[model samples]
Target: MSETRKCMVCGQIFKLRAQCPHQRYCSNRDCQRERKAQWQKLKVKSDPDYRENQRRAQTRWSELHPDYWRRYRDMHQAYKERNREQQRVRNSQSRQVAKMDVSVLDSRLCSGLYVLTHAVCGDVAKIGAWIVHLTVISDLPVESLKIAKR
Candidate 1:
């Protein structure tokens, strides 16, 4: 058997296993959490393009599922209610503070196509959605469309 090594995060002596040849952390929960956090920190610091790519991917995913969080909260109403109750308790204990929430609207132009595939209006709805999107895009000035394309 090999000698036990000290954990990098908690300095606790831990045995190495065949599964993980370079196990630097003990089986402690806090040590594992700290190890993961340190690895993520180093990854972000060492890779410059990684953050930008991650942001772009997140934005694309959010655009694809705009109502994902709303649906999740609705499905987990009990969890949402518990969170609201905890927030209310914290607010009651502290003095009221006024806060202004600012959000910037994006200027990029994109259209969503919603088709109701019912028995009567399946093809009609698709054709109508395409026609509407085309009409809206054509209404924009040529310069605006060019800028939007950028």
Candidate 2:
């Protein structure tokens, strides 16, 4: 006979398997998935070697399939839109990305030296965003930044 225990993930009562006495998650797929996720998170936090290996593996995978994300995004419109929205929030609060309404932020744009970055296609909005407290790399005046007719 095995002792009954509560599942750590779903909080459901389950009996420990006779073979596995230290099982923290039940046989449920979701619970097993959550258990693995929690275990991986802990491993990454505690093991520097594991974290570095995982990063290297991910980099290798990305290099092997550079267009994987692009193809996935193309196949999944909702995913693409969600990522774009999150990116907008990230851009708006580049110092600290958080979930909040951008419209509530200060709308006034101060005239100062700002860094210009190219926006990726279909991701960034038309409104310009630049870093604050920008260091001027050149002695050129701010007015010189404006472009004239070609």
On lDDT, the candidate that comes out on top is 2
Regions of model 1 farther than 4 Å from truth: 6-13, 17-22, 26-34, 82-150
Model 2 residue 142 CA deviation in Å: 17
Work out the TM-score per prediction. 0.40, 0.57
How many clashes in each structure? 0, 0
Top candidate on TM-score is 2
The total of clashing pairs for model 1 equals 0
lDDT of 1 by residue, 1-150 (tens): 865899998787889877889888988999989988888788778887977786799999999999998999999999899989999999886533322342232466444323334243233322223212122335445544444333
What lDDT would each prediction earn against the true structure? 0.68, 0.76
State the TM-score for model 2.
0.57
Deviation from native of the Cα of residue 30 in model 2, angstroms: 1.1
Clashing pairs in 2: none
Residue 137 accuracy (lDDT) in model 1: 32
Q: Residues 16-49, candidate 2, lDDT per residue (tens digit)?
A: 9888989889989999999899999999999999
Q: Which ten residues in a row have the lowest lDDT in candidate 2?
A: 97-106
